[model samples]
Target: MLRLDRVSAGYGRAQVLRDLSLEVKAGEILCLLGRNGAGKSTTMRAIMGLLPLMSGTIWLGERSLSALPAHEVPRAGVGYVPQGRRLFADLTVAQNLEIGLMARQSGPEVREQVLTLFPRLRDRLGQKAQTLSGGEQQMLAMARALCLRPEVLLLDEPTEGLQPSMIAAIREVITALRAEGVAVLLVEQRVDAVLEVADRVAFLENGQGGAVMSAEALRADRGLVDRYVGV
Candidate 1:
């Protein structure tokens, strides 16, 4: 449902992604694995139109996402939870989610569905985002993105800094999203987490995609993880 073809993007003269090509199909979870500075986050930024592409194109089905402004990208059936969560620290959980709904012009039903996925957020609706624990903040971020009711979801390190239990909860939600037919493009440093939820894995090396493999294949031959991700 989401396609990136020979995408090359960077900040100013320092190019980070070079001729990168990949696709995330509907109902599929594709995890991107790479060490730091491998352009994983850059790929997410390129897809979100936060960084102007130096070359290539990004497409969501037939619509060219590269042509849309950053603000309009989310409205075009794309939901993004960038690394660091980037939540409105001062806003209450409910208010933060409301911003996401407003962006898509979504209704209360969408809010209900998101809250259902993140039940913990329901109890903390009035709590400031900055006051929540690390795991709770992460849940709120994902819940806010789901409020967009997007067909494609871009998640960058959604499980970072969370405890094992919270990690499992986040993974469960990701798997559920796949069952619901949301295309997921995830950038994760945790190999175990990737193996648990990803249908396929793409390795990024020095701003280029090196290999694409099924999650099972990687599980069978974990050496690939060391080769690509240096773990």
Candidate 2:
């Protein structure tokens, strides 16, 4: 399991997350929902070691993650897909994926697994990342992360600007990751989209997420959906 033990983090002098504690269990999808400035992205940054921890700790099973540097976090079995599909647009899909292979020096076998996940990538290996469509680029970004063979995956706004078909494909990917016992912490705006794949939901309001509940409960209560998630 991946856990944040009352973690507080921020950028510069402004603190975004305030005493936030949460967990993403193995084989489960924990969706994070929040409005703008709710600190959902900040929370993902804290877990990925991109932001410094102000207080408390983060854990991936028995290992302490709060103190690790950003670059080292990937080797710690944490894969991250930031918003906007941050790929090397000028590079070919194969070259972009090679960057991820450098993290663990993984062989061709692991690379093959990632390619298998997104067959579209297998065909576009020689094409520059910028030439691919939005959905294809997102798939490449995710495939690069999977190339890391991470135990925990953090995704931010994956469905943004995507069509329904692409959203369904990403949903299948997340569900497959869960079935493989890879814990996923998903930061998404679409409640229905996340709920379709998520086991639980956490609402981030005022920089805190204390009310983590089962997806079933959230789905059953229309009022709760109105109160916490307007989108």
Candidate 3:
């Protein structure tokens, strides 16, 4: 339900993304794969209005999001989970989640939905985020974004550094989001992990246009993915 056309973005004179275009349809998990500094995260930043686009257009359904401010992105139906988790280390688990809901007029029911998805958070509502395990922190980061109930979810490596069990949990979460018709734009480097949940894959090449591949093709022979982004 989200599309970026001929998008070029940069910081000052240094360009990171060059004419990148891709799409994420409703209920489909589109995985963005590429080597480090391949503009994958830049694409996500541009989509979330966190980074200014030097030139291009971003759209959700019929609404144009090119000119929307960074603060309005979540309100515009796009939820973002940055690579580092970026949780408030000092804040209580519940407090961090409450911050996301403040952007909208939603009620506690939305919070409940997020809690339901990550049942582990239900009991640690009062715990400081820093004390939680790495996996738990990642779950909380994703849960905070889901509190926005976005039409399009922008996830940047939700399983970067965690145990195998956490990786499985994230995979199952992506599968569940697809079933719920939530369009997901997942930027992950772990080919095997995301392949189980991805319906399609897109490669973000540095200073070039991206190419799309069916998830099946990548699954049948993972070397196809390794060809572009490496194992």
Candidate 4:
């Protein structure tokens, strides 16, 4: 389980999150929905220790992650896929995957697990990341994160800048991850997609959290969506 207790984070002198709090249980997908600059990315960064927390605590299961550094955060069983894919354009696909595996404390068995999910990557292991299509790069990004064998995964805008088919493929992968009991914290702009896949939804506005409800409940409440998540 992952828990954010009244967490507040920001850049130098500019606050992006205001006492935000939320939780994602094991084997569940928790979606964070909001307009651009609503602190969705900030929340993910804070959880991963990419950004320093100004206040409150972040917990992974029974352990506290509030004081860990960014690189050290992932070793604690948290994997982060930032907003951009952040691939190394010069590196081959295999090289990128190798870097991810280096972060893991586990044995070679974890790399085997990642390759099982992204078999396509195995075939194109020698290709440069920049040469791959947008969809393929996205898949590689996800594959790299999974190589760490995280207990909890935080995904930011995973479906952004992709075709419909690619989105569906990624959705299938996420579903499979959940089935394997990996908790996911997903932040996305697609309301319908979030409603379809999320077990629970949290609507964030400005820097504060508004309401937390089940996917079905959020889907049924059109007023709240319009008020906080205008199209």
- The residue pairs in collision within model 4 are none
lDDT of each: 0.95, 0.90, 0.88, 0.89
At residue 204, candidate 3 shows an lDDT of: 78
**Candidate 1 local accuracy as lDDT?**
0.95
Once fitted onto the true fold, the runs of candidate 2 whose alpha carbons sit more than 4 angstroms away are none
Clashes of each: 0, 0, 0, 0
Candidate order (TM-score): 1, 2, 3, 4
- Give candidate 3 misplaced runs (Cα > 4 Å): none
Clashes of 2: 0
List TM-scores for all candidates, in order. Answer: 0.99, 0.97, 0.96, 0.96
lDDT of 3 by residue, 1-231 (tens): 899988899888999988888889999999998888888888988888878898889999888888888888899889899999899999999999998888676689999988988999999999999999999999999999988888999999999889999888878887898899999999998888877888999987785556688899877777767678874
Give the Cα RMSD of candidate 2: 1.0
Residue-by-residue lDDT tens digits, candidate 2, 93-128: 999999988898888999998887788899999999
TM-score of 3: 0.96
Q: State the lDDT of candidate 1 residue by residue for 1-231, as single tens digits.
A: 999999999999999999999999999999999999999999999999999999999999999999999999999989999999999999999999999999889999999999988999999999999999999999999998998899999999998889999999999999999999999999998889789889999999999989999999999999989898784
Error of 2 at 42 (Å): 0.3
Per-residue lDDT tens digits of candidate 4, residues 1-231? 999999999998999999998999999999998888899999998998888889999999989998888888888888888878999989999889888888975567777787787777778999999999998899999988998888999999999999999898889888899999999999998888887789998989988988988988877877888878895
In TM-score terms, candidate 1 sits at 0.99
Worst lDDT run of 10 residues, candidate 4, spans 104-113
